[model samples]
Target: MSSLNIATRALTTNMAALQVIGHNIANVNTEGYSRQTVQLQNAGYQSTGGGYFGKGVEIATVDRAYNAHLTREARITASTAAGDAARLERLEQLEALFPMGDKGLGSALNDMLNAWADLSASPSNSTARSVVISRADAFAARLRDTAGQIDLLRNSTQQQVGEHVDAINRLATELAGVNRSIIETAGGSHVPNDLFDQRDKLLADLSQYAQISVVPGEGGSANVFLGGSQPLVLGTQTGKLAVQRDPLDTSRINVMFTQGALATPLDANTLGSGALAGTLRFLNDDLSAIQNQVGRIALATSSLINQQHQLGVDLAGNMGGNFFVPTGPAQGLPAPTNASAATAAATVSNPQALIASDYELRVEATGFSVRRLSDGTTTALATLPAEIDGLSFSIGAGPAAVGDSFRIRPYEGAARNLQVAIAAPSSLAVASPVLVTPGTGNSAGMSVESLYARAPSANLTDPVTLTFNADGTFSATGLGPGNPPPDNPGPPASYNYTPGQPLQFNGWSLTLRGTPTAGDSFAIGAAPSSAIAQNAGNANGMLALRSLATFEGTALSDGYVSLFSDVGSRVQNAQFSAAFSSNVATTAEQARANVAGVNLDEEAARLLQFQQAYQASAKFLQIAQSTFDSLLQTVGR
Candidate 1:
């Protein structure tokens, strides 16, 4: 009876080992399935008077071949790779928008400047004037088109963020349900290895969306966290991730993690690493920064050109108006969470001083603090209407709370609505309004040098005459309405004369060289239709803009190149990071697979070994049975 019992136990244990080997072979290709091994040990020993007799083998417990460290490393590296790849995808698109050669914003601007150069050569050519106007229109169209395409890209990116958030929420809920199932099925002595595999697999999938932390909980349940200590899954419950728009700037959105009634918004740079984190980072940082750069160019182009255009006279001999309409500063808006009625207003005070960045204006105990979002730098302001980066901020209305905040975007949408306000070729300001004429009857060989207007005033165009007296002195007539108002509203009593000297009058400058006759007289005044046909002074100003270090200490063309290179560099860096992280992730995953991944050949070898054991146990059982039968027959005999 004892021999039979031992054979029976041996046969059952070997058979169980064979079954485990077969199960491993069946799921050889299953993802996240850890290879299982059968555990076996001696059933027991029965002690008698003579000695102890060893019993057959018995199954102990099925164990999984898994290493937690390798698995965790794999997930971490995968999350990093996902984030870099996603950011690189968006940056490549941005790079294409700001091109290097032809079809670029810089190219359009160059062509426009060339048009002005042509007008300078032929100031009275109607066709040349029309070409300048046409080039202006074309440049404006390109600006608007580029801005529109960027807007579309931004919209697409924002939509993807929403989709990623939805996917994360769904994954969280599914994982929570799986956790509940784990709790229910884990209450037995025999562990549910399959359920453990499922839980691990779900966790790996969830890690693709956001960086997370997994903690072992009771009865095989896991508590998952995200956004640093914010629980996404607490045992059997799930939290939600959502997108919320900035009340100050609706164009921007924020991501939040909500559990029960508690919710918190994530900082732009603190999401760790994942596909969702990458998408949000790109949407909030990359998109806004590049758009601000493009808008900065647009604002500078309009502001500089229009200012010069207003100082000149058009083909019709009328003072030139704005050639391109100025764009927005996108006034600051108080945050919705603020508890104050105080408001802040912003304006583009000096376009040349502007940089492409968003700012945060927070009311402080002392006064206020302006934070530059680009580099996380803050500037304190103890007064209102202060200028920073070309944006002037002033208080408007009542004040209350010290912690009130407002967002100020000086160049967000400035490029979107840029347009050429000049509709006719005749509106091109190629002529300087002020003109200086040398004395026709001079005998001292006096010659006029360059003459141009420096500014404008109510009486800037008023006519003035200078008469060289016999005492080597000059008297000015009809000069009261211009520069240096005449004493008693009449011409200056007298003025000393010097050869090769510049005379400033009536918002204009006149330079003369060579000796002047005592009776010599010169006339200077606003250009009439007669002078407008031959004047190309203001066109020269436009040509000078090509070499002006007006855009952040670089020429307008060089500035665009700088921006393009900056974006390209970002894309290149992201590509390198993505590839490196992906390689690391692959290494980690392989390391994990070496331990827990099912191997068909290994399983086959174990299957054969277990098969032989089972056969041996069966033969032993057969021998035991035969002996028993033979003993019974002998007793009967």
Candidate 2:
């Protein structure tokens, strides 16, 4: 190679090195920018006819000082971690509104139950009734507050989504600008590394708002998808996304693209590792569910206590006062028919409208009676004893009557301390007076209670005489008390093995095979026995007030408290899990960033090296100049 060629090669090599150093320094503070380096090699070979070689320094290529594998790993780690962290942050914010343990919904529910129990222990105490009402209202208020908080969070997320949409569009515009610059400057075999870096930065920023996939396109460009196969940006053009209310729930916002309202389904999984996904999960999944559960508890508690308070007689013997006014949404009541007055009496066209699963009614006439509406069964109550059946039957003053009318209420078995027990007789004969046996077994001792519980049969034509002597012994003689021979003609008789279980007690049952004479006397036992007692339905047509009872405050029934506690536990666990996952992902992302991060000190060293190389090339040119000058002078002499 000639000296001119060598000098030109040397100058070009120095220039290339200088260009790389300048580029690196210019982009020192730019995000996503990688330091560049110049690759040098011998110039293209020129072969003489006989295997000779001539060469000059060649500028091979300019490449970025980046580890592609490490960069890719870092991106994946950072993207996933960012998504999780964003989601967890949103959840934590929501959870702050509803704390766990006794101070939260669980405690409120427990307080309401305790109040009810106290009222049951002292049914006539005005203070106890007031306490119950107050506590019930507290529970409802908590629910209302929780629901409000959820709404607030949901609305906030929607606002953020709107702002994010605007941001994404702006980012798209910026990226498009970068794309134009890159295409103009270095679109072909060589792309401007800095401009490409700017574009990549925009892409990474846009992904934080939504889930995106990118595909390389012609002209060193890319097509971006918002979700699944929905295109948001194609080459130089960008798609628009708008925030709109969800059709089903106006409180929520949905993201939709311009063409045919295309949208990426916003869910925890789809928005997998981005801020938008986190906000969506918090609003739709976590906060919404908490609101629903709390609302249910409130509606149930408020409706139940209010209904019971209406039915129960207060200390002043007043009925139908406000016990616990619900603070949540107003409960829809079934419109009353012309024939009925009570809430239950109103015909319900839609069962879904029923807010509470409990019902109660207390009727006090010659005796007191309590009923539960949930299962439509009456419980024969004996609070203060009253004279009945030639013996004293106890019943409480129960609740006061509003005029001649009585109110029926549904009881929440899980929320109160009251329990039910059915009483029935064990024998079949009427020789003994009715006895109180604690109702037990399936269907509350169906056998003994069925006689009265079921409608009486009208088949027996003959009048059966029950002879109760002053002694305990009792007998059934002729229809008119005229004693006849054992073989005299009479109606057929039957016998009952158990009192509540009906056997044809007419003479036919006594003589299943043999017919009983009309005047014949049959001995039931050496002593008096009793027939099965049935739960007499309330005077009203509906059996919706039979499962209620009064009990002490210390023993509350399994009701709203348990349900509330369960809800709190679920929320706590979900929040904890999300936070844990977010933390782990964040840690991993930080580690990856540390490994691939650019160091200013290292770039500074490379700058000095390139500068020194340029100076050395300049010195070589100076030596060649001085040698040429000296050779000219020597040749002239």
Candidate 3:
């Protein structure tokens, strides 16, 4: 009876082991299936005079070849790699917008300058004026189009963020359900290997949506957290991610985690590794940089051109009103939660000094201060009306408030807002408003080389005169002594005549070349019809703008070059990071696979070994039955 009982136990235990081996072989290609094996232990021993005799083998719990650390590592690398790759993909799209050669912004700028140069050669030529208008219109159209494309990209990114949030909520809910099932199925007595594999696979999938941390819970349950240990799934309950408009910039979308009635916003900078984090990073960092860069160029170029154009007379002999529609002196955006009706506005005080960054203006109990958002640097403000970098900030409709705050993005939409206010060829401002008049009583040759108007002035509106003395000296005054006062030999108020030298005063300057004899006089004020038709001074000034170092002390075209090259370098770096991170993710997965992944050869060998054991157990049962029958026969005899 003892022999038969031992054979029965051995047969049942070995058959169970064989079944586990077959299971392993069957699931060799399963994604998250860990290699499993049946554990064995000796059955209860029978006490006898010769010591203890074993009752045969008993099956222990089945164990899986899984390592928690390896799975975690694989999850982390996968999350990070997904982020890097997604950011790189979007960066490539932005890079295409900058291009090179004739299709680029640089080409557009060059064409604009060339059009002005053509107008300078023939200031009254209708065709030349039309070309200038066409060029300006084309530049404005191109800028508006580029700005539109950038906004579209941002819209697309925000939509993706919404999708990711939805997916994250779904994953968290599913993981919570899986946690419940796992806890119920694995009731301390038995280890649910398939459930564990399913849970691990869910974790890996969740990590791609947002970075997550997993904590082991009672009864084989996993508690998951997202964006810094905020419980996404705790026991049987789950949380979800939601999206919202940024408090300051409504155009930007932000992520939030919600559970029950509690909602926590995820900081963009600290969202950690995930596809969603990468997408948000692109939206905040790369997208804003491109918008600022492009808009800065538009604002600086257009505003400066308008200023210069205003100093000139158009083909119709009218004062130029905005060659390109002026941008800003703009109202700053108040925060959503501002305490008062106080308002602020910003204007281009100096385009050359403008930094490509947004600013935050906040009012404390004592006073108000502004900060550059890009690097968290403070810019001083003397009072409600102050200047920072190149922007003039002033209060609009404010009375009082302790925590009143505003967002100032002076150049944010400047490109999209670019327009040509002057539509006709007759409106091209290609001539200086003031004319240079040589006296008829001149004794020698004297010529006006060039003229530049630096600012508006009453003296410029009135006649200003330069009169040559017999002693190689000249007197300059807005008074009629030189305007009608072309006389003076005194050295006290007169300047010594120098050829090819500029005579500057009252916000305007002029270069004079050649010998100046006694009684030679020049006057400047209202432009004659011939002057408006013949003079190309303002057109030359417009052409010279191409080389002006007004964009962060770099030429306007150079600013575009800087932006293009900078983006190119960023694209290259992003590509390398994407490739390296993907490789890292692959290597990490391979490392995890080495331990928990199914090996068909190993499983086959185990199958054979277990088959042999099963055969031996069967034989033992047969032998036990034969011996018992023999003993019964003897007893019968």
Candidate 4:
């Protein structure tokens, strides 16, 4: 090679190097921009007489400083962090509805119970009765409000899912366009560093919404897959994503990917990491469970209270009515798309045994299969009134077809439907129906103690007589309108009347204390008409409700507390996970940036090195030009 050619090659290589250095410094602060470096190689040598003449350096290619492994790790971590953050935000909103301490649902339940206790102290006190009613209404209102808020949150989450799907579709389309551009620009020999940076930025943005896997294709194009398998982008062809309602559960939202003629639905379990996955999980898992739990408390409270209230007599001598409106059963009609006209209905068989869950009934060739949504427990269909977990299932009028199915949400609206049934204070039942009296001319000091009418409707028009005998045994004569009618009618049934022992007969039990002398007797009969009808001081029935085991062998108050604890624990766990994921994502991002990101100091030093090289290359060109000029002058002379 000649001096002029060598100098020209050197000058061109340095100029290209300087330009690459300038580009790097200019994009130092650009997000997702990888540092660019100019590769240099020795130019080809020419054969000479003695040896091959050396040639100057030439520019090979401009390469991007990007670590694929670190970049992938960062993207994955970012996806996890985004999902955790989204879930944590929703959990915080839900947790806010259940404020702890004295202002929460537990406190509301306790207040209602305490009002009941106060009413028991003065069963006929108008103010006490009104207070009980007011507290009950307040409690129901609270549950309704909480349930309403939860539903609103669920709807909001669904809307957010739709919006994120739209964004994913938009980004996928843009990425495909970039892929086409990169292929057209760098298909021959070199990597399009700027286009590669643009594609990487798009990938990072896409990862926030969904877990994506990118496969490098020919001609610098990439094929992106969602959730590892569903194709999103294939070599300049973009797939669209959409949010649709789940067929089985109308309230649930599902993400669908459409590529060509095929569409696939993605659910929470299959979607490994993304904001969309987190929102779906919260809506389907956490929010639904919380709503069901709240509804469970409402149902249990109403059922138990109504049961106990029915067993008591009001001040008007009338049977007590339901204290609170019981929750109605959930029925599922045939789906609109079902070809067969099959329907199913559910009723609460035993409220005490109810589990907080939804159920699905599917008609099979043999019969029907019922599965609980919460735990996926299945049972074969039985008779019309088949009972399971406090629910009674009944088939509709006609036989169901093989493909017919229905979803039964037993507690879906329980909380919202809870209300006080009794509006009047006089309707409160707080008295017993039977009374006991000591016989006349008794000297044993035995008195009428506690009495409970186990069978209030039993014929008790005439009083039973219990006489203490000298042999320490008692004889009971059936005196309650018995004309060969009473079951226990006999010739003086005899029994030992031990002190402090309950004397039980004729569906009534009485306890007597102290010593009983001979001829000492007691009478047990229906309470006097005036006392039964007008007495306003009896509170025994109301007091008994305090210790009543209402739900799942637990008191109503304790059940509410348990539900509150569960929500709080879940909120705490979600927050912790969000924080941990955020920390990990930050670390991964830092590691990636260390490799691909540009530093001002480093770029400045490169700028100086390139500038010096350019100056040297220019000086060599100047020397070559001067040598040529001198040689030309000598030739002319």
Candidate maximizing TM-score: 3
Taking all chains together, each candidate's TM-score versus the true structure is 0.85, 0.59, 0.88, 0.85
Q: Which candidate is the best by lDDT?
A: 3
lDDT for model 1, please. Answer: 0.81
Put down candidate 3 lDDT per residue, 1-637, tens digits, no spaces. Answer: 9899998988888889888888888888888889888999988899999998988888889998899889999999999999898899899999988878888888887788789877777888999888888888888888898899999999999999898888888887887888888888764766888888888988998888778889998678889988887888898888888999887786678788887889889887667878899999999888898888898889988888888889888767887789888885767788878888988888998887888888888887667788988889986555777888888887778474778889888877899989988888888778886667888887668777877665566666568777877777888767432223333445546876678766666656678889888889988876776668887878877876777787667897677898788789888998998899899999999999999988888888888888898898889899999999999999999
Whichever of 3 and 4 has more TM-score, that candidate is 3
lDDT (10s digit) by residue, model 4, range 217-256: 7676778988658888998888888777877777677788
| Tens digit per residue, CA lDDT, model 2, 1-637 | 2555666677778778777777767766666776677788877667778785656677877876555455544555556555556656666676577665666766776675655444333433446545644665666566656666666677777787678678878887777677666657653666566666666667677766766777766555657776566677776777777777654344456766675545554434655556666666666555554454444444344444444333322222222333344332121122222123422221222212333322233434554443333245555554533321111222123343432222222221121222111011111011111122322221321222211111112322244543222221224543322223333122333221223222334311221112222233322211111221121111110111122221111112333344445455655765676567557656654554455345667667876886787677677777777788888899999
Best first by lDDT, ranked:
3, 1, 4, 2
TM-score, candidate number 2: 0.59
* Cα lDDT, model 4, residue 236: 87
Candidate 1 per-residue lDDT, tens place, 442-552, comes to: 876677664656556666668888887666667887786435543332243677666766577776667677766687888888777777888987787677567667667
Model 1: weakest 10-residue lDDT segment is 482-491
Model 2 scores a C-alpha lDDT of: 0.47
